[model samples]
Target: MFNRYEADETYGLHVDNAIRRVTGSSVTVRADLSATLFLSDPEGYDGGELQIEDSFGAQRAGFELPPGVEAVNLKDRPPLPRAVLEPHQSIVFQGMMGEAPRWEDLHWLQRQTELPILVKGIQHPADALRVAEMGLDGVVVSNHGGRGLDCLPSAIEVLPRIRAAVGEDFPLLLDGGIERGTDVYKALALGADAVMVGRPQIWALAVAGALGVAHLLRVLREELEVTMALAGTPTIADITAEALFSGP
Candidate 1:
């Protein structure tokens, strides 16, 4: 969650089907009100609509505050001349999240840094091609895993076509459905720069903490090495789709 964006680098806008303030196909979000603390002076950065007011609280139509309510503490709807809740009490709010971001917002982000910006969840081959054409540095390909109503294909299943569409040079980071070392090898063979392994690590962490994670990584490495050896590909660079081919 922590990032070091230099003077020339800035954040971008987010837009999903629901216009969420999220970064990718999947994001870790907090349901409660969130706060952003600025370490640097406001005068030091590019001035835009960076600081927005945090107007929060429930937004239910025709929901009037009880006659005596000044500030709701939730229980005991008494007539009040004074505040009901302490300044530190927990409260729920479903305030406006604002409009979905426009594609033009990418330029605003690009103006700040020379660092590569990779968009996540570029599932379609055409989308991948379009992203590359738009000068995006790369993309994180994903299936989103939950098998939404459309029954979208996995990243690996579409990865080859995406690679063909974008060419070999553009960076492609495959994510989701990667459970084993052979999965990693297959991703590479099918033209992924790298693969993300979040679930297995989470499982490992839940089972044996940090050392479990280390053990999990070792196991994956051994599996990949064994697969490479059996396929007669001595090095990662030697793996290709042909190596994975057999009659089918």
Candidate 2:
């Protein structure tokens, strides 16, 4: 299950029970993995822990690694040595069943799973490299739509630096100020593998719920196709930094 935690919410063992009831089996019985998304300011509160259950019925605890530690390589170790969060912050974890163990136990499980972990809401090249070091699959350069911190660098502005940090062949995604195909194009030129749209989806949901969302997606897809054709790019792979230039 993909779970998201907001500020002031403690997702305890009850989550296990809920998953069991909904899926008609325990989390261990059904899920091979789980990813939790955190959407709060880590500084706003304390004790919101993300606990993962191993196959042996053991629970391993993990938390968001503090900011500025993105330079720390977690490839063979834990990405977040400790829990950390700021508003609009998020992390992904690989869930495997085992005995509920201490931080060390969780670290062991993370090393074993070897799942591709990617963090969103990153804006610094150093931070991106740190994520890569943690052995993350990649990163999504984003500013949470300016929702988390004011005066934050736009995701586009930081893409080049982040790409340079991670090196070529590293999968990089982009988010923020992405409302049009042109925005997507710009992100690709700046060095992004893909882009995520948040506000537009929310707006569609608010205006029309499910149907509105469907329409919104359709519109975006059409716009992307048109933009691609106009840019003379026949495929996503063909769109590159050469297609863009610094404005005069």
Candidate 3:
């Protein structure tokens, strides 16, 4: 979930498991992994920190919101609680957002993750090259599905440039405007190691829930297979940049 915090807005320290009621049923799922991406320039915001605790209880803090924000739990049991802190008061924890990441943060993240870390929403070749220099596992070329910034170019438009910058061995993924199997094929041919489908899956789920999602994926896979065969690319590895062309 992309959460945008305005001035003084804060999310109290909490685990990510969420409860959702769908068709009069409550469903809960635990996330195996969590990723936080900072969109706003570090200098542009204050106090909206991405703070996390390690398994050993050590803490690190990143981005944050403005000062004077106090966290209150209104649903606390026993007696009703009185306001303890005023709006102008800023609380400091063991982990504070006073320091932001430059080089150390990236190295810290790489050290912590056993699984491969792929940074997403990268549109610039320089950013892709930076990801490689930082020793990141991969990069996803995306315009954030065009949901965050409407004016940005599509992921496909930048895929080749980023791919060229990162070199052939680096894994690159693409996300955005993928409505058909042909779209997926095009992305792979254009240099995306893989493609992500977003709204189509949501639309399918909205129409028929799990069954719809399964059917839609099955259809997409079949269509992709047919496209590959018809285009004379028998395998995914065979798909190349020559398969794509620009049009007026």
TM-score of 1: 0.58
For candidate 3, the TM-score is: 0.58
- Model 2, global lDDT: 0.70
Give the Å shift of residue 92 in candidate 3.
22
* Clash pairs (backbone) in predicted model 1: 8-112, 8-113, 9-112, 68-79, 68-80
Q: RMSD for each model, in Å, please?
A: 21.5, 17.8, 18.3
Q: Worst lDDT window (10 residues) for model 3?
A: 86-95
Model 1 CA deviation exceeding 4 Å by range: 1-98, 147-150
Each prediction's total of clashing residue pairs, residues at least 3 apart in sequence or on different chains, is 5, 21, 8
Error of 3 at 221 (Å): 0.8
> How do all the candidates rank in terms of lDDT, highest first?
3, 1, 2
lDDT (tens digit, per residue) of candidate 3 on 81-147? 3222222332222112333345577788888888898888889999899999988999989888688
lDDT of 2 by residue, 52-128 (tens): 64432122345555776554455577533332322222222222223224435434656877676667777888878
lDDT at 75, model 2:
50
Each prediction's TM-score against the native? 0.58, 0.54, 0.58
